[model samples]
Target: MNASVLPYREESLCFGPESRLIATLTLPGDHPDSALPAALTGSAELPPPHPHLHQASRTSAHPAAAGRAPQRRPPGLILLNAGMLPRIGPHRLNVELARTAAAQGVSAIRFDLPGLGDSGFTSSRLSHDEQTRAAIEDAMTLLSRTKHAPDRFLIAGLCSGADAGFQMARDDSRIVGLYMMEPYYFPNRFSNMFRTLRRLREYGMRRSVIRILQKSRFTRRHDPAADSAPVPQAAPEEGVRAAPTPQHFAEDLRSLLGRGVQIKLIYANTLMGHWDMRHHHRHIFSKLGHAPHFDVELVPHTDHVFTRVEARRHLIRGMAAWLRRIETQQHASAA
Candidate 1:
């Protein structure tokens, strides 16, 4: 795909001194005077703090320039993920989202978690929880120092990153909106496990299940052509349950609503082993009395990673449309 048609620019950024988070910052064609909105992706290794030397340099040079031209810092949209995969599946999705958002005047960013990508290795330094939250905090701090400080913040996540994104929305009042794509909250490698277990159950080959997981890793090895994705031998035992009740989607939504933040969650329509991810999504959202400042959407025929180019585009377009709606409402309300 020709990338030049995309609206955003890729940038290298860090939140703090000990942090090595490489983020892509995208700005609207006309920025600064605009109401800034940011989107962030989640990562497993939280980013440490860093100074906005670029923003600082501009400010220092403009001591006498005050309202002269006003720094046109871009509104931000951040992408959060636990780690980098072999291919840029999620990264491509986020970049497309940023491009679409920028077309409509929203700035977007997608960054590697602390230890991933060009950032220094803190890879296994923090738990998924700490890393995710820290990434959000870093994004917020960066936003604050930019020309668009105080602009509303929007966050988006995938898989474990989504789990952390929800946690950040609950903890931070400044986050005005959230979008989650294919949140992997199902217990264990629920979908894949279910598929494998069901296949084993039907064939009455329970013993072979372990062997399959072990052997599959060698054959799969991150190949896009592999029929079965590679799995680590030590990859947590199959069918293991997730801790803390998987952060009930409803509860997370309620928390965001209570703070007056809008949240949109999208789940993949795939069976997670014995568990149906779609059913879980329904169970969580059906009980909500009024959408709880949250909206739920399901993307058909898409997997957790959203690797297919068409699927990625669809996800990005959906996000762009929702963001535009939110911006329109905010503008109308302000007017």
Candidate 2:
């Protein structure tokens, strides 16, 4: 397929009260009509139906005879922002991913959440959770109106975007697959500290000491409770909440898995300080212990945002392969 010919449309989608999100919707082109087979030499004639056979039975055997419509494809992809990055993604990763995926026959929509990118804030105040949920619901509603009217959805995001995607999959059954890059998985303090010490040892005593001093100074400067003087705790924001504990994350993962949601978790090497390594996923979700539904990949020599050219290429390829796998699985199940 000449990908350049694929059609795409850009529009402003309204979601929450007084909020408008900028989005681009891409559609896969229809397959070229097959030339009628040159009249086959002596093609076998079809057998006549039984005298009492119902019209429905005949139609079922030959759908075209009754003008039965072709089955609709599943929902298209949804690309989200990473942290405060716009829908273009860091280094235009989201745009690249969407276009490449579209070339592969997976339609996609990349959009900005309210108050982020080009989107406007809601009329009324909404917490982070509320806003995330509402924005996704709105995106789904918009996609549902497309010609495909896709009911099942796949969501991909990086960092905080990944966090929101995970939360959405947990809450919504319609979400069938999630692509998460450097998602916010809480670290096990003891294991994390051990790994940090091991990493420091590799850096030699001199550099490690300097790093420790810098870390200590940073912690002391930021620790309001470290001072002898009594200080009042800052109040939490109206809609913002504390990060979820490992237990909460584990439970959520288990729930999504039980619901047959396919998940891909890619962690950049920079996250080793917190996530330690791929095996640490077991530490976080001991009960789920390497469930098949969860596909985890560790990107070596990469920063959280995959800023390097090689790293970006690696990310794109990895995501494309995973998306293809999910597509195959969906088709198999549907069949």
Candidate 3:
């Protein structure tokens, strides 16, 4: 295929302090942006953050900045590293999602924070969580400089990555969307019942059936792929918080909703481990009656790490669909 006709183009980048952080930038091709609504692809424009920075980004030396006039940042997403996993994500899930987002006319960047993947550790005094927040802000700044992309941003993360994104969203107004996969879920009165159903009936019976089949030599041995995704790393050493109190969570979430921020909680399974259950947010949103901007999803029968191909497919599709919905609404409201 010709260089210009490719569905999308990806370029490696070294940005942040001393230009040491590693990141990959993916931008949509001409045809890729055609299908997405103008809202999702960025329609209205505003002036760039800085006149000098705007001029620098328009220089032809950078592919992302090249060929576009200085304008307000377009809509984009920041794909954070899953815990300490590289920016590519487990099984390169981040790469797949970035390409998918590109196909819809949005740009995406997957970057390594200090000490993860190819990025080196920092000597800063800030704690890890604080560093993560700063790194995310730096990513947005990088986009503003490199691609003019960051007016309204989205973040996709899993586990610890999800937690960090959640904490950052509370303080960062630029963040307009968040995908928190297996984010922390505080338990409620229904927690024990859900655990019983998941453990004895859901898990125990399946194991029993498998054991019976193996004893009778009637079925092939069942083996699952190894999942190397982060396993609940220790709580944030300082600064950033892991989980907020239920009251604080409800308050903060309501505030985000008031600001039109979209939230999607993607769980690995229905009522899986960690005292969580489907419809777990009733206590939080009960008085609100109906909040159009909030929702929950469960990738049924998947493990915590989402090793299953089908699970990841479901996640990517859900993300794309949600992005379209939220962006369309945002654009309509802005109009």
Candidate 4:
């Protein structure tokens, strides 16, 4: 398989002189002529724009629009948080995902947080919350000034970036949809641990396990022969945490569902109970119960980064299918 270098345009937009963000608008150079028709005809459901969704008083002038049914490019702005270390999983994943979205007639823009990337300082230098909020504002401000106000906007992130995306959608209803790859929540781990303890009686050697745990001195050595039983560990993914109490994650979920934003979250199932444990799937699903506006899908046999070629391919295909479904639903509703 050949990996093509994505082509993009660079522009700087500032919410404030000292608080500017930089982004690269990238797309595949050799998009097929067939994609336009597919994009327009692919009848899929689209979550309605939030009341706060904004658009510029302008129209697009791209070639595809000239011969189509008022085709408007879907523009997405990706914001990365500076609070975490830069890694390949998210950076490469976004690059590839953005390129794929663009090939399918979507426009993607990714920028560094205020103090991260090419912008300035480390996340520790400033308030993390403030930086995330400012990043969202910057992304939104950029979307408003696009050649054509983005007909659709999707926000995505990884780890701290995912946290930032969640906060952004909560704060700004303009973000119609959210695609969080893996959101890292630290406190969720202890919750899972306690829950596991409650089920200890199911295992015959529960007393022995507790004894071992109580004696921290004996825990220093890893005894493969200690027991064939399983132990709770952090999720093995790049950025994930153990499950949190349903009540604890309720605020974030409410923030998302309260604004009526549809969420499409994808993660590796194997990451559960490990370093990247994320057991809020049921909680999120229950919170969104009976809400026709939301959809969720999980991809198995893939790691957080989607390093496997097949995993990446599946991820892209799933995204395309979801987008098409949304479009179909929107047209049918109008008719």
Model 4's TM-score against the true structure: 0.61
- Model 4 agreement with the true structure over 1-335: per-residue lDDT tens digits: 12222232223333322444445544323323424533333233322222321221123222234555754445454535424443123436666666556556555666666555565553344565675675556555555554434645777666456666776676666676777665543335466675456346445476758765877766677877767877667655334444445565666666677666667666654333332333455544565566555655556766666667887677667666755655665566557
lDDT of 3 by residue, 51-124 (tens): 23322221223234568755444478889888768999998889988887876767788899988899887778
Model 4 residue 252 lDDT score: 68
Give a tens-digit lDDT track for model 1, residues 242-333: 43454465676666677777777787755552246445556665556685356767777666677567778778778877877777667665
Of the pair 2 and 4, which is ahead by lDDT? 2
Give the per-residue Cα lDDT of candidate 2 at 91: 95
Candidate RMSDs in Å, in order, are 10.3, 11.0, 9.6, 10.8
Spell out the clash pairs found in candidate 2.
127-239
Better of 3 and 4 by TM-score: 3
In order, the Cα lDDT scores of the candidates are 0.58, 0.68, 0.72, 0.54
Instruction: Please give the range of 10 consecutive residues that has the lowest summed lDDT in model 4.
Output: 53-62
Error of 2 at 221 (Å): 13
Q: Model 1, residue 333: displacement in angstroms?
A: 2.9
Backbone clash total, candidate 4: 16
Which is the better candidate, 1 or 4, if ranked by lDDT? 1
Kindly indicate the candidate among 1 and 3 with the higher lDDT.
Answer: 3
Give the runs in model 1 whose Cα sits over 4 Å from its true position.
1-7, 31-75, 86-91, 122-128, 187-243, 246-248, 272-278
Q: What value does the lDDT take at residue 177 in candidate 2?
A: 89
- Sort the predicted structures by lDDT, highest score first: 3, 2, 1, 4
